[model samples]
Target: MATPAAASDWIRYWDEASSDYYYHRPATGETSWEQPDRWICGEGYDSSEDSARRSRAGSSLPLEDEDDVDAPEEDLFVVRASLSGPPPLPAGGPPPLSLGAPPPLPVAAAEPSSAQREERRRRVLGEILSTERTYVAALQTLEKVYMVPMRMVADAGAKVAIFSHADLDTVFLNLDVLLKLHARFLERLEQEEASGHFGAILSGAAKDIKGCYTRYISNYAQAEAHISALASKAPDKHRYLEVCKSHPDAGGLDVRSFLIQPIQRVPRYRLLLEELLAHTEPGHPDEADLREALARIREVAAFINEETRVLEKSLVRQGRAFVREGELTKVFLFSDLLVYGVPTGRGYVQKGQIPLGEGTRVERLPRTEHLTHGFAVVDGHGKGYTWHGESEAETGEWFEEVQRAVAILAMVARKTALEHFTAAKAGCTLIKFNHRDGRSSPRWVRISADGSAICWGDTKSKECKSMMALSKAVALMHGAKSAAFYRAQGAKKDRDWLCFSLLFRGRTLDFAATTAEGLFTWYLALAALVGPRSSEPILDEEALRARVAEMI
Candidate 1:
């Protein structure tokens, strides 16, 4: 058999059976013969349409070259046939039509030209191609089986039946590359075999695969290189198949924290609320109270959803009014609850400047102006939270209110995170919280039915992603600033200090760094500090007693 390099090099090829006799023919050399040796005929060549000229001895027939006709039937065979016996013969002589053979299979005999291969490739990779892996596998496997003739036409002296094996291997490898590679900038790298451009293509493919498979980046000149790299590492198709199956679902979008936040917070807060309400409620009936609370929740929910449907974009547009002069600010979830209504769904409030049209305008977010006074994010009761819209400067009797809000809101965030993690695993949305304003709620309160209390931070730290900092960020920024302003004028500072302390994880939070499992410890410490009367737990007589003993 011809080496792949030499076979592809020239227009000339020889009969492997007759080493000394070479047949210099067109790429597609066509002749009809019966029971011919296993020769790679000019399968791809267009046969001449002229009538076959027969050289017969009769005067009526065309005469052969008399000199060549008298020559003995000498076959210059290079490799002798391995068959042991002189078997069957037919009516014809030296031209070899004497041997009898059955007709060829239609699909096998219908030869494909080089142009046909190109057409097949284009058809297979068309725009509406199926991405279903199973279909891809079957189609690719079938293609490998069908390209036997083309392989022979391209490589003469190629083993007759075995030619398909090499063709199948190469085609399948190319398919693997085409299917797996993804890139932003792709340039086709098909080239002649001798120039060895496949090497360059392989290198480009490796970089492309790394970027596409690993991260979103610009890479790859052609897909071929990726196949070459994978081929080097895992020569067997099964290994490549395994890798393909294990890859992440490339078509789906990444799950963001928004959906996660709601689904998570809902169930966890429900459980915590159920536990808290069960312990705290008096055994004696209070149907009116539950009804009133449910009605209130409905009212908030409706208002939030309504504004969400109508004015969400306008509010988003006007959010820039919240940006202070040269001050950078973020949503501070509490602002979401009060001004717009719901971060998850909708809002009831319109986006108007503080002094009606006087505030700065915004077409986008990171609302900087009123940002300092919006909400706080923190962790309490062993979790994460956003303590909604309450200024930290709640001194002079309002101090008690800030403490109540902060403690409850912190528990809400923890439960939210837990609920989200759980729901994501289950692939469903379990919780729906409401956002609304509570102007009559002493300090500005925006409590969702769920436990999300978004508060603003007042510290110098501008962009804090910490749950604790977020819960109280608005208060820290606005209230803390107000507190400092007061301190500068010799105003009382007791309440502001307490708000800051509460946000810094209270006393338990202070000592929390030492514990390996500090989240629960902080919750216990905080619950103890907040005490039973304020919490008003509907405690199990036994559990409450145990808790009290532990606290002591």
Candidate 2:
């Protein structure tokens, strides 16, 4: 073989220059053409070497490196690399070995010329791949947040652009995509940096990214604020609380005996105010009343915020203990049906009077006199019995106290049921209903305009607050059913019965208020309209199906 110097010098010339090489410069730069501006190749340049290099410039095309079969892939970059200047013929080194570079006219030359160029092209491809991956990843993250979870789109087809978790990625992707485009535009900008149009592409992309990001954050903040407002509605929920949170003591307390006129007026009025506000256009000058109502809501919210904390705590404590005969098996455990004969210590009884607790400490299961009005007979702890009160039950302090005390029990029971059911995903959410009497039953039910969702008529009771929760829990779990709520009339007052029409029915518009009698009339009318459940439904379906079957 020729001396190594000859071969090395030959290849080095092309490896460093070729226009083809720069075009493919992977990430870093690489060269091609065997000509040489040996500014980089130092220490020994003979007169011949300089003369050879000068000839190697892009002009008098002498395809140097390719002649060597061992040439590297750098020929790719060299084709693109810009080049200029004289070819360098080395000094009295070894004989020239043509690595495509012009050899010393039969002088010793060896070695491949394209080694460095190959390295350069590899680097450039890597850069492109990396940038593409980063951009795509950001786009995917954004899509996940805005499209998948929120909005009713999953239930209905089509997704809306809104903030969820992945919305951030969308914002990032916009910026990234813009930058990539900008970069592409600027590559042509290098030569004409001073030209007015040089970086127009990049500037445009930058602006696009900025606008999209701002819009995203703006929408995200608004959505988060709305959700926060809903959570903050807790205090306002108290405006409907009709029961006295704490009972009036026998001394300084002057309990109101009649319906809480203010309570009824406020919540209903607030609803009206909401409607009025809803009607007001944002910029309208005729919005003074709306504005005042909004101010009231704010103030009311603040006041409710303080009171709810105290009530919530008391509610929790009340939910834990119960007063009953024998050992407490499941105190405060509210369920639609209590499985009789649960095996517990102190021996339990399914019937007759039984003490709620030990010693003179007792509670008899009072008999409920009326089915329309639910109650359990608890008379001095022997064998407990059940009693149903009538629509004509007595009113007064005793009635109220007894009812309120029973309601306290109901509240605890409701809390127990709500906790247990919700945790189990049982679904019927027991929200407390607004009731006028603290001493009356704690009103709780699932209502609809037809009272058809749970019941057919309103049945006010001194007992509903306690029994209604269970009625609803059972109805929801089993199917639709409704229980009437009758206003408690101390044995002295005439019984006020609720009508079916007044009771809300499932899915009907609850825009009208009907009395107990009116509600009953409506239900009778509805029953008449539908004929009767005992009669076959959809006579046409049965006849049509029979005809089709006969034809088949």
| lDDT tens digits, residue span 351-446, model 1 | 322211212121111325654333332222223223223443522112232333333322222222232223222221111101111010011111
Give the residue spans of candidate 1 off by over 4 A. 1-283, 315-318, 322-552
Candidate 2 lDDT score at position 472: 16
Each candidate structure's TM-score, on Cα atoms with residue i matched to residue i, is 0.15, 0.18
Q: Candidate 1, 206: how far from true, in Å?
A: 65
Q: Which candidate number has the best lDDT? A: 2
Worst 10-residue stretch by lDDT in candidate 1? 432-441
The sequence of per-residue lDDT tens digits that candidate 2 reaches over residues 389-415 is 323242122233233333333222222
